[model samples]
Target chain A: MTSADETQQRPAGDPAGPALDRFYTVIPAGGVGTRLWPLSRASAPKFLHDLTGSGTTLIRSTYERLAPLTGEKVMVVTGDPHRDAVCAQLPELDEADLVLEPSPKDSAAAIGLAAAILHRRDPEIIMGSFAADQVIAPVEAFQSAAREAVVTAATGRIVTIGISPTHPSTGFGYIRRGQALGVEGAPSAHQVVEFVEKPGEETAREYLDTGDYLWNAGMFVAPVGLLLQHLAAAQPELHAGVVEIAEAWGTERQQEVMERVWPDLPKTAIDYAVAEPAADAGDVAVIPGHFTWDDVGDFAAIARLNPAKEQDAMTVLGEKARVYSDQSSGVVVSDTRRVVALIGVEDIVVVDTEDALLVTTTDHAQSVKQAVEALREKGDSDVL
Target chain B: MTSADETQQRPAGDPAGPALDRFYTVIPAGGVGTRLWPLSRASAPKFLHDLTGSGTTLIRSTYERLAPLTGEKVMVVTGDPHRDAVCAQLPELDEADLVLEPSPKDSAAAIGLAAAILHRRDPEIIMGSFAADQVIAPVEAFQSAAREAVVTAATGRIVTIGISPTHPSTGFGYIRRGQALGVEGAPSAHQVVEFVEKPGEETAREYLDTGDYLWNAGMFVAPVGLLLQHLAAAQPELHAGVVEIAEAWGTERQQEVMERVWPDLPKTAIDYAVAEPAADAGDVAVIPGHFTWDDVGDFAAIARLNPAKEQDAMTVLGEKARVYSDQSSGVVVSDTRRVVALIGVEDIVVVDTEDALLVTTTDHAQSVKQAVEALREKGDSDVL
Candidate 1:
């Protein structure tokens, strides 16, 4: 069955029996957007900006997009700096839905945290992990695909929503789809064969042409039992650490367990620590997401999502404001109480704040965090 | 002989040469620096900035550079908007020396005005015309060159100073030098065969390899009578009108003559109006410039003049700074309040102003005024 193009077309009627009604969303908002510096500082990130002028951020927009599939069953896990902003921006999510990370860690830790929290609420809970920074369009289709993924997860297989590859993008990792999985009427679900690292452009082009490679969008759906079993079998150390942190969930000893366990845990991505292992286990399933998706990694990608009036331009705050951005372009944001002008410049970013100014090229936007490291190296801790 | 760089050296044996010498200096300060825009505005040019860190603006610096030969013999002729700045910067010059124009009629009118003024003072007075933005090293050698030119001008010939080109430069016009025509012991001065405009890269390289072409630095010394003779013979309208204006100097009616005459003056270069014709007249001579000279026309030229510390990069106002400016260059005016960084960018100009900001590629710096035009288009008059 084909889903409508517009997001608002909710399913009017489904003569088939109702699907599993126990899935909940877990938003990993703890990741920092180091590449989009100045705009995306330590206090804010890509998910926080109203990128599309819809008066909503990516996190808030993503939640609204999933409303039909799992109404009011979402949780946001963020750090201290963004905790207040997340709550302030999304007043609908109560304090209980906001999971605080004691310190910054990888997505694996976040997955464990989400699973533990869901286990406490319901041991058999179907959990779907969503990244706050991703953009998924055609909401109705995403909802339908996600609903199918949740149903597949209830069947004891770890399910991931793999985005259909639209281009030969070298920015994202690829998921090789295998033999077709059983979906009553949905063409979006498949059995995942393998997970590949970010490939060369030539290889990515091949995958795009083949139509079997799906972008590993870093979204997944699984039952608490299934995830815990995978973690226990594949990553026993992480499983033990998660268990320790979860046991201290509602006590004064919570910070103690977190502090002791987090720093010592291995730093790895969920793809390397779980998805790759799951693919090897031969039981993992892939749900091909029938939606437009973007992981705003750098200025080039950000410019694409917020396409300029011209071929490669992107405007930020002021609508009347004009930009001559190329595929390699950023902007000049001046707080000088006067109009700022940038001419004949490409690939560079100039972000002016009330007190501080950042002028660097887009290729170096990711290394801005290294400036903080430099400050620390020189013992200029105050700057950091 | 190539002279050693020494600034502000004068006669040890003949100190009191010309107390009120009839030597006149004409400053062509009409250019709108689009490359250095926001800093170098339409109202303010590079000659107004203390760009060299010697406590003098470029105009003031040029004045200081010529102080040895033309002691109190300076006259600054600029457009109406920059008249006050020119006057305010060079306080030693009288109000009469501050020649204001209705619009930028260019070098032809400026030279004509200088000739008229100097002719009024003394028909045989030697006049030296200098651009307000050039940087001349070794003031001592520059004065020596001017002294030689003044001696040559006393014989009623147009003495143009031709600098020995250090590279195959396509930026400046070239003067093809003929056989030498100076005293036995004096520096080499040749007859100028022809003046060529900025050439293509290959032509410039050919000119450089020939070793007979010197960069036409736009500096010239000639007697008022000689310039007046050529102007009357060729551009008779401009000459006749300027002569009427000169004869009625300091009278209430002179202002009328200026208003009536200047508005109708042909828009042309002094090279076209006098030098090219004078070459056919066989009265133009090229004296080799003793001092190292640079026009500081664009950012690339500026970078070549002011080489970077580590390599050949130009860093301006870089303070408490860690910079890696190289073949990929930019002006980094560091605010101690903020850390500025750049990477993988080439031929860029970054200017930080209190009310406006400008960042442009050096190659595109010429179009930076277009950014100002854009600001004007957007009705941002204050910033423009």
Candidate 2:
């Protein structure tokens, strides 16, 4: 593996200047997206879908959004099942930059493996990890915030881009910002007071009223060495396992080591294993991001992102001409070639797939996962 | 043409004695069933569907219910397009008994033509006309009512089987009953005072409270000659056209006369052309039916006929095993072999077919026809 100091240089097309020359984007692309089924199946999850009807898949959009800042320094860590799909969707990504996990070990192992690989290649590389399934609007604001976060991460603190809350959302974890860091290159950087789990509606409303809390978008930026150090201190076994895999990543023994050690790695989110513990130690910082962001959590969230042409018409995510609706409102994910007719329904969510069909309302979007579970329990794996 | 005095006799399966010996059933199997939409298209309408999950199509169920009383005396009157489907569904019907119309000329022409042909075959034959799409439960009560209606028709009056009201439903028209007829064999028979159209909720409630009104289920029984005489007096042109078609029915000129006269015949319902006017002329009698009957007008009616196993489960018209529902109600007509999962929807109507899908609620079931119209307007006849 070559070091950043020896191989890294400002790309000709990079408009962010040399300040971001050493920045690398690591995208953790994995999630079953159970709530979005039958559109998002286990074999083809949400990250592989062009959910916004924008003619680009979510992973492709993520790659495009970060390409300007990181140039060719983008790496994606996905499960083996989705490895080919991710590569096919993102043809611009270098084959060497695609890290395929043998099996899911949650966000902790997925991101930590990418961090280990980046650290081995360039110890000084400032890596920012974004989920492949999120939707971020107003690219300029995200770029500005990411640049500032990268600058702050160079100062040896684990940093996260906190989305400024626009509503009292109980879906995402809340990050409480304490005192201002007043860092020279990053003026918006603040000391993360504490990280809290997803709260109840009342607590979320209180969080909005307090004006001190930001939505923890699960986006983190840090020097590869610093993130690895936190991981080593908090979860030594997981850290050591990833380190071994990273060492063999570019060698002939890569597949052999992965097959032996991958499944044994601890299954945990990075927040519980690193960010929370690091925040408790007063070694965490946050950059307030003004850009809009969403995990595309459910159909209701998808409806909000893609508003219907008319208030009463459904917002179709596939071929709009195939849908015939009257006095209906909400979202329709139509992947099938057949016509979908919605009449006199309100706030409905209809997902028409080839082998399965889902009909529900926006209010019960989260309960779709229960249907998936029921199907699995019934041994109907073909649909799942 | 032979008369009933020479042809009518007790068949091998005749169970109602000699009074019903000359009785025959005429089922008018027309109507596109537009409100059911994709489940009931113009090519394959609702009459051919097993909407109640009873393992029998609506027309087949109609035949099975009346077969005990009429034996092989049952006749189906349908347009040329549905002739094959009606025959395929009802294999027991004699080829001579299936009255195939060249084109749709509405109820007056269809039923009047059937009556005209039956009058020519057996002038004393008492015929009862029932819709091919209605669901009549507790066949015993229907048999008893029809027996009384036949006896009342023998008294030279146009008798109708009126469904006793179970609720203040505004869906069906009300038939106001007059003084009870002092007849021995037909004790429940009463003189029909008048026929009223579908009323408002308050008016329906008032009618229900009066105890003198029964739902006009459009079930009429009369001697073939008496019905023709009423049609001849009320709609002379339509009567002449059907009479001309009937005169040529069994001859070599059957096809020629039908093609020439069927399209030009007056398109009017029997209620307007004969029944309502006959009631004003003091010739219509009413036999109150105690059996439960539904026209299966829409998904709401289907839900009532096929109640869900659990309150939260969907009332599926197809294979219930293919449906996975949670906190959902109303009905689902799944013709496709795909799994349908409904979550958090209330009173929803989801009809999944091979070429189209319909998603709505029971309240908006009537509006499904609008979707079909819209699809037609958009030149999406493939789905319509």
Candidate 1 structure quality by residue, lDDT tens digits, B1-384: 011212234344432133215466777777866556566667677777655545567888888777756767677878888867887888787887777777778788878977887788877677889898878888767777776676666656798988888889888899998888864323576788999999999999999999999998888988888898898888888888778877776778877788878888877889999999998878998878757887665655555555555554646653344433323565654323454445556666666665665566656656665666767776777655
Global local distance difference test of model 2: 0.88
lDDT of 2 by residue, A120-151 (tens): 99888889999999999898799789988888
Number of backbone collisions per candidate: 3, 1
lDDT of 1 by residue, A1-384 (tens): 112322233344541114345677888885556565555666667788665656678788877776556667788888867877898777878666777877777888788777876787788788888888877788767877787787777777789988888789898899999988766644566898998999999999999998999998888988877787778778889878887887777678877887888778766677766778878998688988878887666555555565545544434443333333323346454333634566666656676544445666767656667754654576644323
DockQ of each: 0.33, 0.71
**Candidate 2 Cα errors over 4 Å, as ranges:** A1-19, A166-171, A174-184, A190-213, A276-284, B1-16, B166-171, B174-184, B190-213, B276-283
For each candidate in the order shown, give its overall lDDT on alpha carbons.
0.71, 0.88
Task: Kindly report which residue pairs in candidate 2 clash with one another.
Answer: B4-B122
Relative to the real complex, the DockQ score for model 2 comes to 0.71
- TM-score of structure candidate 1: 0.73
B285 Cα displacement, candidate 1 (Å): 4.7
